[model samples]
Target: MSLSAITLLGAAGEAPTLTVVGEGVVLVPADVVYVSITATVQDENLTVASSESSEALNRTIEALIEAGVDEGAFTAGRGRSVSTIQTASRVCNNSTCVVVSDGAVNLVREEVTIRFDAREEALINRSFEVARSEGAEAGIAGYALVDRRAAIAEAREKAIQNAEAEAGALASAAGLKLGERLEIFERSSPLIREPSYAFDPLGMRMTDLFDLSWPVAVDPFETASSAEPGMMEVISQVFVTYRVSP
Candidate 1:
């Protein structure tokens, strides 16, 4: 049920007033998406590990550019390390499997990541496909809105308008003339059902990709990763109080 109230708030400090809450919603397409491709290698020799990782990383970048993604869109990835080195320990017993010695690193692992922004749906799908084919793990970082402030402002205006209209209807229903707005309050927030892959850093949802009515990749010639763009939802709520004329 909607929240509403009639209280004693008047010109003489004791008259009837009507209060109501209103909400506004706005839907906007996703303007950009964050994509990450990481090439990882593990070997007993550090040089070999590092060299192979760089090769895989380079292949990923070349494939993305060849697939039509802008080279300038790429950025240094933020994760483990650009040149991170870790150590491996020796296990003493098979049953216990305890670290017997903290000796020199028996194995070395290297990870190189590259991140970029994709504006077009086809490019985003292509980026994922090409990166994965090049022996790199690919994933979506998150969805973003370039015009976030504008969308919020429009939703707020609609909320205020809706509050006024509802307040007027309530006052007239109680056999009183709608006078003037006594008070207005706003504590609204934008709400969206964004997935937690960016939050968890492991997986993403197809909800954004399939939620919209973009064409499914059924054609043999259609280059795609079987995904599409998603939308963002913005909402604002407002409370308004109006004094009634007897």
Candidate 2:
């Protein structure tokens, strides 16, 4: 809801505890721009289909490089599949009809996609232009920071401090004093098996993930798509329980 979500619970023999959920978020510019090219081709012969795809892919890469994109900035892939196509039609002669022989042929379909980091402003715009001129689909895949873990580390500290501040303020309003933390929990990403940062209440916090600088791109791509890295979020949240003196 708000920046903090608070809850209160008590038991017969234990001190009343206040639990609050705090959140932190940071917006950072994109460090890298991902440019992509895709080509879809079909032919009766698999060899021909693969060749067609390769030709289109090569053309796009060459154009990108010629536009000042280095070869080291490229990533590419290709895939192939086969399916049957119907060609023959039924023929009838005075109520006598015969099934056509060899009415189907194998059609090979191939797909190729080339990706690259168009880190420079000049190369970034040229990437989309090259893909478009070469008869290939042109688009930007995404933008991201180089150091995501460092961003998360900063957010984690803010969330913890925010939780503590909210608890203290709410405790004071209720005529009680804030005490030591009883339990600490981190709300991490479900998709991530290993979190970027961890908490240790034993006076030993993870130091390797923090105190890092993420330099912004020298020339940020003006949001042609309106969905640039400026919208990306490096966020952290926590649920903290604290004892409240009666």
Candidate 3:
């Protein structure tokens, strides 16, 4: 879709006006993936809940580090606490109702985010496994392209070309000649959306540490040995404006 506006130049006394607006879009594959690891603990004791949640998060972070992920690639988010309530209701013979409350239990949750190149599929999968085994939940949050600026620039050039073509067609239809460029305005910025992936362990059992035949391995840089990686989309949009003469 496209739109345009006309503006008179030179102190509103000019005979010629400028007509502008053109848009272009492009799609590219995402090159990076963002993974989110969450740890949650619920108990009557706030301290216990918080401690357990923190430990789970720490374990996940350590696993990622062991998998060859740089320490800088992970960020810890703010911790959150919520009250879980339990309620009981009783009905009397006269259709009257009485309600009793058992008070509230505190639940604490913490999260860590990991950013890495999508090519590190094995490492990403290993991180998920480690987080889950540590009693945390892990999933892919979204995907991103490494060089968004370059993609936007390419899309912008295409948009300008589109605007020129439209201007030429409009000028021809109006029995006028396309003139020199007067103005270029961007209608909107580039739009990109990263797709989310749900975690599915596929019933893979955790290797038993005591089983020497299937000994637990500790490698930080290893990618997923089995699971397939996911993909995301990157979109770029550009708008342009030009002038015409009779």
Candidate 4:
């Protein structure tokens, strides 16, 4: 991407101005991992469905706490309930007609988000295992860096240095001495790319039962252990204008 800026020196005076855009990038390993666990229950009775779903969610939370996850690092979202209806279809005279069937069920679902230290692989694995054993579906959500502000600051400084170096080089090549800095503008900041778990389905039953909305070619659970930590890049850009001395 390009950074652009405009500057006028001394109210349109005849002094030459140099404007340059510089970019900086840094790559870092993620320090934290996030996982979202969802528990679902369906029954003909709404009360039973809601109760079972809540119980399952509570068990999952307890299991995560037992697996050494800090309670503060996890959050439970509001529970959702929906009424699902079953329909029967009949084709007669090259036309299809649908009729509502007696088969109707209430579904209740609750979700919990857990944050784990990336370095603690054992605890992370155990947390997933316990959640799954407690009738919850678990999957990797994303990853994050611990010191994001520091990384961004470093990248921004590098961008400033790069702009200065380019400006000086251009001035020297043109037989002109670099003068005072006129203006500095931060065009962009570093961006962190979160890992996607949209395509990963841990178990076959999860794939078969849930409305994942996409097809999974591989089992995420079988390959998650071998998967490497998430990688992210920080990028910064700045536009600078400087005065020129003849």
For all predicted structures, in order, the TM-scores are 0.59, 0.60, 0.69, 0.68
Candidate 1: which pairs clash? none
Q: Quote the lDDT for 88 in model 4.
A: 55
Candidate 4 clashing pairs, residues 3+ apart or interchain: none
Candidate 2 Cα errors over 4 Å, as ranges: 1-15, 42-46, 79-119, 165-175, 180-184, 187-230
In order, the Cα lDDT scores of the candidates are: 0.62, 0.62, 0.64, 0.71
Q: Of the candidates numbered 2 and 4, which has the greater TM-score value?
A: 4
Per-residue lDDT tens digits of candidate 2, residues 1-246? 135556676879878899987766665555666666666566667677667877877787788778877777665555566676777656799988876765555555444443344346666777778877987776666655665776677777877888999989889988998999988797454111121233233322133234221111111221122233334556566889999887
Ranking by TM-score: 3, 4, 2, 1
What is the C-alpha lDDT profile of model 1 across 13-52, one tens digit per residue? 6767777776666667667677777777766566777677
Write candidate 3's Cα lDDT for 1-246 as tens digits. Answer: 334534444356554544655555555666888898888988888888888888878877887787788898885565465666565666466766677665667788888788978888888888888888878888987777777887778777876787778778776777777778866766446544432233323312233223222111222232333323343333233334444567
Error of 2 at 110 (Å): 6.0
**lDDT value, residue 116 of candidate 1:** 39
Residue 152, candidate 3: alpha-carbon lDDT: 78
- Candidate 4 C-alpha error for residue 219, in Å: 35
lDDT of 1 at 18: 75
Residue 227 shift from truth in candidate 2, angstroms: 6.5
Error of 1 at 228 (Å): 9.7
Which 10-residue span in candidate 1 carries the lowest summed lDDT? 213-222
Best by TM-score: 3
